[model samples]
Target: MLGKGIIKGMAETARNFLGSYVSAERLTTVQYPEQRIPQIEKARQFPFLVFDGDDPMKGLRCVACQICEKECPPKCIYIVKSKDKRVDYKGQMQLYPATFDIDLSVCMSCQICVEVCPFESIKMDTAYELSTTDRFGGLMVNKHQLAKSNEHYRHIHPTDAAASDAALAVEVAKAQAKAKADIEAKAKAAAEAKAKAAVITPVAPKPVAAT
Candidate 1:
């Protein structure tokens, strides 16, 4: 019984070796690139900006709030708010980033930027193949390059993208409703003022005639 355990282990190993050629379940080797293992849904490697529509620059969800830039652990993100104002997709006047950059060489791929972002404009990208030959700026990504469509975000992270989209829709609806209420209140106030003016008689002319 002393050598029984060793015999069993050796027999198992031999069986596996022989079964690898004939049994589909026994084959474990993978040919990468051409036949890669499926990536997990939660797997993330880098950060990318999410845009709403076809134009990346005009449709970017970021208002250049600089929260992500300040919260970045590695200090890889850089941004500058635009001086010119523009109306966003939500019909609110907002400042876009004139310049945004992320140095991939220095990035730690921490999801803190994505978490601290208030606008839901930042997301972790699944791309990991970022090899480069240039030393100065090949890995330095700018706003134009970092911007990706919301459709792309849904493709990579369907659940998260759906939740964010729903939240944004709710916010937009709230803002629109507030704007409509304000307009109605102003119109009602103006109508009341006009009615009070019309109700007032020509008492001033009667007083002048008595003088």
Candidate 2:
């Protein structure tokens, strides 16, 4: 009975060994550089910054609040607030990161940065081809290198991207409605004041003449 189990294992191994030659699926190795497996949507390798529009720097959603950098488990993320402020996607003036760097060598790809980020600026990238000869320089990725378009995020993670977009749309709509209400309230108050002034009678002219 003991030897029967060993025999069964050997038989299975032999089957796989021989089947590899006849079946493409059974092949242990794939042709590198020319052929590759499709990347899974949830497969994450490293963290990358996501930008909305064509301009990577201008369209970046990160306000450099340092939430992600502070929360990073490995403490790989480093960020510096910009000296000048710029408008964000929500049209609110915000501080961008003048210096954003990630030491990929120390990065554990825990995705903690993505979770802590309020702006949805950072997300996990599926790319695993980070081999480098110049260990320090190559591994230390800057903001320019980490920045990717929102379209790319959609391409890689369609489901998450859709949800994120829907949430953002709702937020924007609420903000716009609030702004409109505030403007209308101000205008209405001004109009009411002007009408009240026009209706008031000028009785001071007779009194001044008596004086």
Candidate 3:
């Protein structure tokens, strides 16, 4: 009986061994360089900011909100706010960001910054081919490195980028329209005040004329 158990175990082991080779025939193992797996639609890889191409300044969507910098766990985001010389809807100068930076080495790729950004300025990119001899030089991406035109953003993420562009266009148009309306309102108020002042009421003749 003891020898019978041993024989059955050996048979099971032999079956398993043969099964490995049998399954290998149907296996779909792709060789590196020869084959590639496509990424999923919602994949997030690296951090990047979107910029508007039509604007001569290549204006970035980021308003220097500092939300990304604050939310970043590694404190990798750095930004410098530049005083906007131009007037806004209220004829008041607005302050925007001048510089932005992100240290990729410190970034954990958690996408917190991207998620928390209200302006949709920052996002995660699909590019993961980052390899360099010098970590410091390669990892520390400045405004120049992080900046990409809206066209580029659309190219990388067509569906999402198109939506974002549409939203941004609406916002920009609204802001411009509000500015125009405010100016017109102010001008109209001034004109009304001038008209009221110009309309001098007729004064009654003095009592001496009756005498």
Best by lDDT: 1
**How do all models score by TM-score?**
0.82, 0.84, 0.73
| Model 2, runs deviating above 4 Å | 21-24, 192-211
Q: What lDDT is reached at residue 5 by model 3? A: 88
Which candidate would rank higher by lDDT, 1 or 3?
1
C-alpha lDDT of candidate 3 relative to the true structure: 0.77
Q: Give me the overall lDDT of model 2.
A: 0.89
> By summed lDDT, which 10 consecutive residues of candidate 1 come out lowest?
201-210
Worst 10 residues of 2 by lDDT: 201-210
Candidate 2 per-residue lDDT over residues 44-128, each given as its tens digit: 9998899998999888888999999899988999999999999887777899999999998999989999988877889988989
Off by over 4 Å in 1: 1-29, 199-211
**Measured by C-alpha RMSD in angstroms, how accurate is candidate 3?**
6.1
Across 1-211, the per-residue lDDT of candidate 3 in tens digits comes to 6699899999998987788688876446677578777776667777888766555234666778798999899899998987765443223455556888888888889999988987778888887777778878888888777877777777778898888778767877887788899889999998988777566423433346557
- lDDT to native, each model: 0.90, 0.89, 0.77
Model 1 alpha-carbon miss at residue 30, Å:
2.9
Which tens-of-lDDT digit does each residue in 1-211 have in candidate 1?
7999999999999998888878887777787778888789888999999998789999999999999999998899999999998998789899999999999999998899999987899999998888889866898999998999999999999999999899889888988998888888888888888777667755434455557
Name the best candidate (by TM-score). Answer: 2
